[model samples]
Target: MDVEEENIESDASHNSNELGDTQRLHITKYPSQFRALANKFAHEKNLKDRRKLLEMYGNHLISFKRSILLNRKRWQQRYLRRQSFLRSVFMQQLLELETTFLELIPILNLNGMPSKNDLRINHSSDVCTPITRFYKDLLKLESDDWLAKFHMQKSTFDWLCGQLKENGQFLGKNSLMGKEPPYERQVALGLYAFATGIKYLEIARIFKITLRTTICRIMKSVAESIIKTFGDQYLYMPTSEEELDEIGEAFYSASKMPPVAIGVLGVCEVPAKQQVNSNSIESENSTIILQVLVDNNMIFRKVKLDTNQPSLFLEETNEITNLSPKLIKNQPVSRFIVTPDTYYPLRKSLMHKYHDPVEPHEYDFNEAVDHLFIFRDRALQRLFARWRILKCNGDIDLRTMEKVVLACCVLHNVIERNEKTFNEQWSKGPHSDNTKYTMSSRFKPVLNELHGKPHSWKADGASETRKLLGQAIYSTEM
Candidate 1:
């Protein structure tokens, strides 16, 4: 505005001059000659540095604002995601809760009815008449009839019942709607269960038990009692030298193998309850292997559940390791137990039949070994025969099965020790499979019966003791 006003004033002055001195004013024109002027501090060093600093500060401010905005956006997105996830979780939890309530509603007893019916407390069945009469006249039954039916001689049964009675278990407390069973009745019930493999209900029907659960309790209690009372005495591997020697001599007398052989090894797999396991698609269960060490008399010396792992007898408990090495026919020999070829890593303490015997002496050794395995197998078969309950496919829990099996083994030993006669006809009866076992009365194995399959296993140097044993047997035969 000032410069324009000045130019107007100058123009007016020049107009006046044109009127007066028009020629001079018209020819005169002037421009300033000083160097072009700009901001005096702009090119100063300090000002230049300050300008650069301001630019950096502006850039920093811009970045900070951008970062703040980005952070807000990030948090907003995270909040949305978290809200979605929580909503889904809340919905799922609510669904689960609803499902749980729905599941529980039916089972809830609003009307105050019973949650479960106790079959033991309220049984509808009555005692069968024949069973009542049979038990009443159990003593009047014949010796052979008793043996055939109960798998024990009358005297042996009486002896066992007496022993059980002394234990003073099975109070017959569960016997509802009928007379309480005595100790004898309890023993009879257990023996019947052991012999029949019959269901508790059917056994109840046959035995006249008013409450089948009473029969179950009677059997379970009796088995538990028998195991607790006589398990150690009846089913035990002898560790003492005297006891070992006696057992060894007895086994030697029967098999004519070697005097060092004390026990015969056998394994019987009893059907057990199928266990629900995460590992297997097929119902995860292994048959309860009753790994047994028995003497010549088919008496179980050692009984164990196969949970001890793969090796059958000596490897499990190391029982034979305790055996003081014995001399048979003036040759050094380890007092050992005989096992089948399937059991391996044969050491002095354990022996199996020769694998693929090539020599004549090998055949001879195999013959003698056959007798040992026959007795071992026969003992196991008789165990199955004597107590058919082991064959029952029905669900029997591990603990109960263990008790029942151990109880049967105890009874077997007691019968053997008492010289109880085992009737041949008993093993062929209803509960038993029609498998024929050789006569233990003679302690003899028929050669024609020796059809045992040979194993393809070749013994390594670890089984040197067993190889030496085969050589010694050959030497003894010579």
Candidate 2:
């Protein structure tokens, strides 16, 4: 491609509008610029110049290390002072930081790899030498400052020259496609510290780096990185039967059975009391109903409701009798809307008590957004894999297959938020004549299946009801 075409491709790939500085550095469209920048700052011409430059950068590096060490010490102090609340938070942060930094090492190493022939570094000696030296000094410092041993010797000049050739001549920003720049590294380290919730100084020590760099990176960079890289993916809401099944399974595995779940939103009127001791059941004003399905194996079946759906109560009330008769009667519902709104108590009761979740309401919206986003993402990936497998296997009824394909495509497109990425594939429009052939070819079999088979869920309503009731019961506290 020509420069314009290349630029377009590069722009598409890099797409800085959403990415952070660390990501931009990794793309390295301007290796030459980074090289020049590094060179302009180097101090060493001979060994002395190398030492001076190394000393300058070395101080920063040492300061960074010290800050981390100090921060860690402070954290330990705090933990000792408070064995209860603050300590757990401190420990949790440390673990998160360690995991993030360790994960980044491979990316950094890949980016920092040296060229085979040293073509770029040698060709751009003016800039390359200084940049190379800066790293060499870092390495030297790591190697316990070997220069001290060679100091005051004739070999010092030769040693400095050797270091200059090797140290200052760095692989520019693009040297490795995935690695980050020094500045980006600073920011990432800071983020690592923040995420780990370690004492800032301690995190600096762990990374062998600076508090200022860490602070700046977290405050200005990491959140954006997470957003750009993970964005809507982090906000994925589970929508598929398979995904719901997996969640049910997870809840089942994590908690116990007999879970209760409310899927939709609506209001329901509940009665005050049932027949007891030969007395008539008392009438009561309508209260919010939290329609839940108590089930073992989850199956979605439509249930007719007598009144409005459930509603959330803002304050505690003993008027439990005002709830819908259907709910009070404990009839199993396939999908029930806990009217008004679902709150934490109901959510916890569902998850911890029963275990089924149509959707989670226990956490904040942002938290829910983040979680469901991950859940849906993993589910879609599984769907994609399944689809590919099905396609590879071939020979299924075309109409049935088509429905599955279309559904998969529709769901995947919605959940992945990849409209821009898959624009070409979907641009014809799902319903367009151009897509009709492909759609028909795959969906014909799915339609045939629908015709041949009565809905299994409909026939199995009783068993499904049992399962739904179990889900509902398990979903809440008694």
Give the top-scoring candidate (TM-score).
Answer: 1
* Runs of candidate 2 exceeding 4 Å displacement: 1-180, 202-214, 217-219, 253-478
TM-score of each: 0.62, 0.24
Best by lDDT: 1
lDDT of each: 0.61, 0.32
Per-residue alpha-carbon lDDT of model 1 for 1-478, expressed as tens digits?
2353355346445544433353334322211100111122234458776576556545544553454455456556666766766665565466457445433332222224443431223244332232134466777989777866788778777777777777747754335233435677777878888876846545544555544345556778989989877887777767778877787677666665767788877754666655544442223454566778878777888887753343444333366766678775565676777765553445566676778888766676677787777777777776777777877644566777777878888877887788756655556755465653222121121111112533222332325555555666677667
For residue 272, model 2's alpha carbon misses the true position, in angstroms, by 45
Worst 10 residues of 1 by lDDT: 29-38
Error of 1 at 71 (Å): 52
Q: At residue 431, give the lDDT of candidate 2.
A: 26
| Candidate 1 Cα errors over 4 Å, as ranges | 1-134, 171-177, 210-212, 253-256, 276-281, 311-317, 328-331, 429-462
lDDT (tens digit, per residue) of candidate 2 on 272-383: 1111122322211222122222121221111122223322221223122122223323653332222222222232211212133343432222232233223333332333
